[model samples]
Structure formats: structure tokens, C-alpha cells
Target: MSLAVALALGTALALPAVAFADADDSDNLMRKKRFGQNTGTVTTNSNTGGHSQESGSKATTETAVISDGAITPFITADGAAAMQAVADKYAAVVAQGGWPKVPSGKLKKGSTGKGPAALNKRLFMEGYLRAEATEGEYAQVFTSATEDALRRFQRNHGLSVTGVIDGPTLGALNVPADRRLATIKANIPRLAEYSKDIGNRYIVVNIPAQQIEAVNDGKVYSLHNAIVGRPSRPTPVVMTPLTVIRFNPYWNAPASIVEKDIVPRMTSSGASKVMRDMNMKIFNGVGGPEIDPDSVNWRRAVVDNYHFRQEPGGSNAMATAKIEFNSPFGIYLHDTPEPHLFHTGSRFYSSGCVRVDKVAILIDWILQGQDGINSSRIAELAETKERLDKPVTNSPQLRVAYLTSWPTRDGVAAFRSDVYQLDGTGFVVGQPLPVGETQGGKRYVLKPIPRSLEAVDADEAVGFASIFRRSSDRIDASERLPGASSKSTDSLVSLKDPKAKLKAQGRDTGKKKSKAASNGKTRAWTGNRERSASEVMSMPDADGTTAKKPGSKKVASKKAKSGDKSKTAKAKADEKAKTTKSTKVVKKDKTEVAAKKPDAKAVTDKKKALTDATKTASADSKSATQKSNTAKAAKPADCKAGADGKLPAGCKPAAAAKKPPAKPEKTAATPAKTASSTN
Candidate 1:
């Protein structure tokens, strides 16, 4: 035997025998194919009791099919092309820093060759093959060493114990090599979404794939396969902000779960000591709620109001550990004695909660891997040798999420069959960013938009109109003053009021006043504002520019004429007032009876004076009109009245008045005194 095979023998005891045997055959076959030889043969032969077998040394040689720098042996037209393509793809992968070609040398002990070296790296990455130590001199890959590692890798990646790098193994290692990395990146973001925000430490349950990761200090410290809720009772995705953890927790058997799964089984087995074995308390007949383990009928459970829960422990009938958080989602990561479930690939077979594989390891991680509770402590707990009460010093954060497609640190993206079919839109699987756009510290995301009222309500149109009217009322109130504090209050007051119209009118007037004051101008104060009504009215026409419609431009001629008519009317009003005063003085008795108070008498007297003033003003206006008419009649006389009040040069007399018109008093209401107090 060669020295290489001798070295291989030393390490054979530590590995499974099937691995090396499979590896030798695979390597030989691959090497022969690479060297452009016909390595395989096809034959059809049959020998039976009823049939005669032809025995001859007749050898049929296999043919080599060559194409695109590859040779396929003993393959037909279609099969040859496919086999060649696979070989070419593998060759390309080997060339890319991905895989390695075997070398001709003396095989060393515990050393993997190029192809196995790449395979080992991948295996270690997938968490199947681990490095026991770095002290050994045989720390590399050779034939025998490669076979051992491949054997372990195959076992961990859920493949059969055959250590050969078969087509399936090759496909997994080569295609989309970045899957693990993509999964990690994609899941990290999804985890962030799950946590609502990242927590200092959190527990994540990847339900579909049956894995749990306890993350602390932004690193994965403890990971285990978890048995989660089943399809019928799927573990809900929740973000529980953990605050406390109880040692020896009570397993509260949810009623729905108990009815569907546990009750029927318990009926078959009487008062099973399963809960008692876990150090739980049973409330079998407590509070008049009877759970006759062997006799209770499950068919009436749904309609029944009685509940059954495992009490907190001390040789109690409940689960041994409990974790408390603030989520309405009744899910907690807890330890289970049934550790065999972790050995399976699909762990979603629980009743709406997570059952962790290494519960002690997770607890230690929660305590930040504190001293005195090391591997020794964990081993003791597993062996049931340690009965001491181990309580957590501080609570750790726990985040629970439903990840259908989770990733590994090395970039292998794992996709679970959507057990719940929860990805309704199929969007939650691979999204890296939030669907919402961030703006002004607020994220506008794609929330499930609510259905319109019209779609839900029978009297939708009436409700819409009512809401619109109420909105209008609110707008009017807000535009003016303190708005209706509440819609209900305003509605109540409107309903209770005896005179809605008067109240509404008062509100309108207040709004108008508020609007006028709030308009572009500042409020007029006592010392700074002293313009009278008449003065303000006349101010707009003061400039030679005519006061046209706000947007128009009228000439000075129109303005001057309008001003002349107003001056003439004011002069006639003064003259009429003088005459009315003389007539009212003669009838003092009647005037006294009409108005007793000075303010009241002034208002009454003003009405009389106003009538006389209107008549005199009309007379003055007609005089001005007549004068204008006379000017037209005497155009040849050049009748320009100078300061002397006489016509310059020769002038003709104006035309006579046509008729006298009646006058009506236009009384203005006196301003009411307002008494308002501000504190």
C-alpha cells in the first residue's frame, strides 16, 4: 500500500466507512471523465429460469461524444448533450475560485483536497461540519480527510449518509451561491419590521423551517430548531416586548387547543401524568369546572363555557417555564422535554407557541452568558441532575416573527412552503425595504386601506350629506371664532334651541364683523383712527381720479361732477335743519310727550330733522342740475361763474324748474353700546 493510503487508514476510525468508499468511486469516475476517456458503458442482458442465457466474451465498446470542449461517454444523442452541459458548468465553477480539481500526490491524514476543501467550507458555513480544534498538524484536506467532512456535511444538510459529492450535493453547493447571504440581508430587514424597531436582544422563531435564533448584542448567540404551532393552530406572528421571565412557568393549556387535540387523547388515557411530570399544578375540580380526564366529551367543548388551564408549578400540572411579554399574541418561547421533535425538518406541529430545542442555552443567552451557568450547568440540567431553582437575573427582549423565507449568515436563502398561505399578496416573502415612503419623520406605507362607508352602510347617501353639512357648519364657526368644541355638543345645542333662526342670524352677524375686522387692514384703535362715516365715504374720490368700479379707471370729469352734487345736497340739508328746528320749537308740548329721555328724544327728533334734511338736499341737488342745464342753454354767452358769483362777459338766464319732488327720511340706526370684559 502507498504511504498516502497508510495515512488515510489512521483517520478512518473517527469517520463513517461509507463516506470514504463513496468518495473513492466519485473521484475516480470524475477523474476518468475529465481525461477525455469513455468511463461508463450501456448494456441490455437478461437471464431467467424460463429463458436461456448466452455466455460469451463479446465486449461492446462505449463511444465518446464530443462537443464544446467536453466529451460524453456511453450516452445517446440527447443524454450526451445534457451530461456534457453539466460537466462544462462544473468545470466553469471550478475555474471561478469556487471549487478545486484533485491533484496527484501522496494523500495526507485529516487533509482535504481542492474539491473537498471547497465542500468543507460550504459545510462549515451551513453549520453542519464544525472545527473541533486547530492544534492538529493534519489541518488540511486530502482524500480521506475530505471524505470524513463530506460525510458529516451530508448528514447535517438533510442528505443521506453517502459521502459522495453527488448531483444533488453539487447543485446545492454551486447554483446561486449567494443564497445564504441574500437570505441574511433580506431577513435582517424583515426582522427589523418584526421588532417594530430593533431591540437590544430578541427571540426570533422561523416557523415554517422550524428554527429559532436568540439574538443579543446584534449577534446570534444561540440557535436551535423549534417545534412551533401546527397548520390548524398556526403560531401567530407577534412582537412581544419582554419585561419579565418566570422560572418553572405554568403551561396554560389554551381551551381551543385542549378541546381539539389534548382532550380526545386524555379521554383515551386517564389523568395522564404528563403535566405533573413537568412540575405543574392541576385545577381538575377547581371552581366547579370539572375535567373528567377519561369521561369528558370533546364534542360539547366548543359550546361549553368551562375552561382548563395548567396551574403554576410546585409539582404542578403545567409547563415548567413561562416568559411574559406585552403582546396580545399568546406566544412564548419555552422549553419542552420532548426534544426529539427538533431532529425533524418541519417543526410547526405545536399548539400556537414555540417549543425550543435548547431551552437552557437560550436562557443563558438571555442572561448575557453569565458565569456559573456555563456548559456544565446546561449539561446538568439536560441530565436532570441539577434540581436547583435557576431564575433569570434580568429579562431579555423577545421578538417573534413569521418568516416564510429566512436567510443564513453566509447568504443561503431558505424558503419554507407557506404553511399558512399567509402571504396574501405574496409580497411579504422577499421585500427588503418597507413599502412605505418616509417623509417628515412619518412613513406613508401601504396600510390595508379601509373600505369606504358607502360600501358598508345601507343609508350611505344620507350619512354623507349629514356629515357634509356638519363640516360646513364647523368651517363657518372656525373661520370666525372658537369653533364648536365637539360635533355632538353643537348638535345637541341645535336640537335643544327654541329659536334656531335667531341664533343662526346672530352667529352670521358675528361672523361678518369678524371677517371685516380680520380683512387685510389692522383694527382701528381710538387715538390712531378718527375717520367718520361721511369722511370715509368721500375719501375714495378725493383724488382727481374718478372712483370707478374697483377694477375700472374713470376720468376726473365724472368725479368732479359727483362731488359738486354732494356739496350742493349738504348745503340744502343744513338749511332744512334750521327750518325744522323752528317749527319743532313751536310744538314743544307734543315733542316732550313723544320722547322723554334725552337719548330717546334725540333719536325721535333726528327723524323729523332727517325728513326736512332730505327735502332741502333734494332742492340743492335740483338747483345744481338746473345750473348745468342753463350752461348748455347759454353756451354762446360764455357763462363762467367766477368767485364773484356772477357770469363773466355776456350771459343768458337758466331754464325754469320742471317740478318739485317729495322727500323721504333715510334714518340711520344708532350704534348700540357693547359691554365686554376681558380678564
Candidate 2:
């Protein structure tokens, strides 16, 4: 048999098994019945000639199952073929060295340059431009044909079809062909995996591309720009069924927002202002009493005690509607108050919920066959601005996926920015993605992950308290304050001791004095007695003790003693000369003089008198030394001793030696008698 015939027979054989398998599960059968699956299943009966016969027939269908929970077969055979065709085309391009990169610059209609030439060549390679269009030199010009081709390429890639080659266009054009091929190869498994058991109608959200598409019978019914969560608060990947559509929905701000955004603003701007501005009402707790904003301490209530709910209005965070689905992450799709955010190429601004453009259209699409929910009814409800909850009889499956690269209808692989860095490819954190990409088109930079704003603000408010806390509180309990000299109980003991009080006061005074005295020059007293004596002598005594001038008397006595000695020596020399001149007469005179000279006893007594005078002088000097020793011993004990054991300044030394040794009176007669006896 032919290949086509064999495939047809295989499909025919597979249909009954799928129908039976679905029938085997009562839940699946009920779901299918609710979704109006296999509506062609019919039974017929006819009776003729008293005989009865029955005939039954059923219709078969194919579906795609992208994930475990997804029941819809959104990808049909044609869709799979189209995707595979694009992949195959890119694989061939990879083999042919891929499309050449356009020069890095902006190129639009009426601009002619090498950039336009390269762009045209690339578009031609990718099948946007026809072969015959690349013939002439004017082909390089940004002509209408080139503009049309560019627009077609942009439309296929989910970019703004401006026909202008902006930065994002250039970035897309510059991606290496090998990388494009790798993306196609990487996604082939996903395409195949999703090619089975999908529902008849479902929603597909491309997280990386920030776009959402509603598919029915393998064809796109609605397309919308999606504002997913920021990188720090990424939209979670999920596959589940959405069963309810809420009109003019009340938005209960998530705990994250209450703690991070609301509480801090409340603390800074006050509860009343924030509450009024946000159009929010505070509740005692979840489903509890309605509390006035002024009734509670916002700083404490925001942390764990209160819940915030914004009344339904145009200014509400959830603009006008919300689509609820079953997922562990509590994520859902809704409309946004800031509709302008949808105009940008990259829409990633929500905390974690997805904000869809023209969400009313999406809602209409989701509630097509459900009772009391149609395009006109939805429009009327939205105009009324009243809260309404509409239940969907047959819910549609939703699949949120991270697909940075995918095949476009024009047989080219379109690449988007890895906004969440989910692909494991290295990229700058905050750098905007290329134009025509998902995240960085209009200067949207990545921000840090949000923490509890109330926690941060509270900490700042208590910063001063933390600063002034005692050492034990700030550091450890065992650690005392620096230089805490006494225990708490010591205050009473210190009061009872006068000496202790004085010592404490002295310590305090000494500290102050040391600080004050450091600024002046200090003179330390050394123990040099000579310098001390000089200083003492220089000053006039108040008592008349130093008035007599002791040094003058000592000098005079010394002069008189030297004068007497000199006279005696001169007289002896004269007597000797006279004895030499007249020998006999001199001899008779010498004998008479010698006889007149004192006897030995008298000479010995004179010697004894001289020894006594010498002994008396020595005794006077010793007595003066004893007096100095006694004075030194009597010095105050508090006086600091110097290096030589002398007292410090403010103490006096012993009085000067009482008197110089008394000088013996001059003895002229005795010297003459001695000279005559020697002659």
C-alpha cells in the first residue's frame, strides 16, 4: 500500500481505541460530554415487517496533550506539519551556512545602504523576499517590496509590523544560524510531546514571548499581548483548566503586596492617605470584621493582623476581569489598569499574575458556549462596572510555557529573549532584550527580587532604638559596658565610705586635670643637689638667715690665714740673713734668743693647741653632715624620691655646714724663736 494509505488505515485503527480508552474513564467521558466532544455519535432504529434492527455510529477526532493535566488536543495534523516544515527549512539553512547577518543599524523604507542590502538578502533567504526581487542593484534600496517583506517577517514573528528594521529587528537578524537550528532541534520534542490528547479548545501562553493565543480546532481564534510577572517574580509554568470568569472583580492584594508594597507606603505616608489613594479597605482578618484604617496601628496590622481588599473599580489592580484556573501557585490571568504597558514590545510588569491586552476579548473567547456569557453580554457587564461571577460549563485548558524560540508560519524559526533566563543560556541580568523580543524593548530593566517592604521599613524605624541599646542588649548578656567601674550595688557602699568618695572624686578630677595639663609644657624635677642649691641661693630669704652672707665671712678668714703664713716665712728669712752677716756677734745673739725661746714643754703645749683647733673644725663639719641626714630622714613620706634618694621639689636640704673650720690666729713670736734656735 502507499504511504498515505497506510497512515490513513493506522489513524482509522487508532480512533476506536482512543474512543474506548476515553470511554473507559467515566470522568474523561463526562468531561468530553460537557465539552461537546464527538457530537456525531448517534444511534438509529427501524422496525419493518414485525422485525426490529439497531445501528450505531461514532465520529473520531485527534488531540494533543502538552502536559499531564492538559486534556485538549490543540495541535492538529496541519499545525504539526507546519511547525515541522519550518524546522526542516531552518535545518536546511543551517546546512547552507544560514542567512547572512544584516549590518548593525536601523534600516527603513527609502534608506539605501549595505545594511538594507544585507537585510534583503537575509529576508530572501528566509523566503520573505522572492528570488526575482534580488536581481538588481536597487534591490538593496529600502523599496516597497523590501518593506512588504519586512512587515510579513515581523508579523510572523509576533513583532510590530512596522516594516522598519529597528534594534530588535537587527538583533533577531544577527542571531547565528547554528543557534537557530539548535532552538528548532530543542523544541522538536516539545512539539511532538504536545501533539497528542489536547482539548478541542485551549489557551497557550508563551511566557518568554509574553504573548497569549486562544486556539480552537488547531487554529488561532484570538491573539493578545501579555504582561507577565517580572523576572524576580516570574509567572509560573502551569497546565490547568479555567472554570470561572469574574467581571469587575474585587482584587484582594496578595500577602506579598500587603507586606511589601502596602505596609511600607502606609508607614511612610500614613494609613489614611494610602488607603484613600489605593481605594482599599482594611479587614480585621480574612473574612473578618471591617476595620477602619484609623482604628488599627497600620505598622503592626500590616505585618500579620490585617487583610487588604480593593473594591471593584477601573483603578483596581485587576482592571475589570479575572480568569480563575486551578494551580498550586495561585496564579491567574486578568486585565490590568495600566493598559499603556501593553503597547511596549516587552510586557513583563505584573507581580506574578498575567495581565492580558483586550482581556474582554479573551474572556468572550473563553466563555463562548457558556450560559449568560457572550461578547455582547460581557461588553454590557463591563460597561455597567458591576461585579458579576459567571460559571463556565466547559472550562478550557491553559498552558503557560517558556519558549524562547519557536517556528513561525512563514517557515522561519522566530527567536525571543530569554526574559526569565529559563533556557540556561548566559545573559546579562538587567540588560534589555533585543527589539521584537519579549522583555527589554522599551528600556525595561530587570529589578531585584522584592523582599518584605514592611519588614524593611520597620527595621529602619527602629534603627535609632537599636543604636542606643545597652551593651548587654546590643552584644551579649555577659558583656558589660566599657569602663563601668562599679556594680549597681556598689553605689550604697561608696556613699558610706568618705575615703572612697574622695578617691572617686579624685579620679574624676585627675582625669580632667590630665586632659587639661596635656596642653602645657611640664618640667620634671631631677635630684641634682647643686642645681637645687644654686636655685635656693639665687632667691632672697624672708627670714634674715641668709642676710649675713656666709660666703663673705669664709673668704675673709681664708685671706687672713694666708697673710699670717706669708709674714712668718718672710721674718724667718730675714733673721737667717742677719746671722750670716755677723758670725760671732750673731752666734752670741742666737744663744741668748735660744735661751729666751720657750722650753720643750711650752713647744709641746703649742702643738697640742694647734691639734685641738683642727679637731674642733672637723667636729663642726661632722655635726653639719649629721644635721643634713636628720632633715632628710624627717622628710614627708608622700614626697616622691628622686634617682639619688633626694626628695622632690618643695622640700629643703639641711642647712650649710655650721661654720668653716676656725682659722688658728697668726703666731709671730713663736716663728722668730724657732728661727733663732735653728741658727
Please provide, for model 1 over 320-395, each residue's C-alpha lDDT reduced to its tens digit, 9 standing for 90 to 100: 3444444333456665534444555455555556666546555555655554765455544434422344445565
Candidate that scores best on lDDT: 2
Q: What 10-residue stretch in candidate 1 is worst by lDDT?
A: 17-26
Alpha carbon lDDT of each predicted model: 0.39, 0.55
Candidate 2, 1-679: lDDT as tens digits: 4222322232322211001110011111112111111112112111100010011021011111122222212234344466678777777877998888798777889988787888888988878888766668776788899998886666444455568987656766777877766665655544444433457788877676676767776655655657677764566555556767888877776665565456656655567777777677877767789876655544334344566777776366665788776544556787766655555655566666677777776777677747867767776776677788876777877776556655554456555566665453322122223222232112222332223544445333333333444545422211122322222222322656776675545554324344333312222121111122223343333232332323545545655655665565566667667655753334545634543444577667666665666566667767877997987798776676678999777776546776554333323334445444434
lDDT value for model 2? 0.55
RMSD of every prediction: 30.5, 33.4
- List the lowest-lDDT window of 10 residues for candidate 2: 47-56
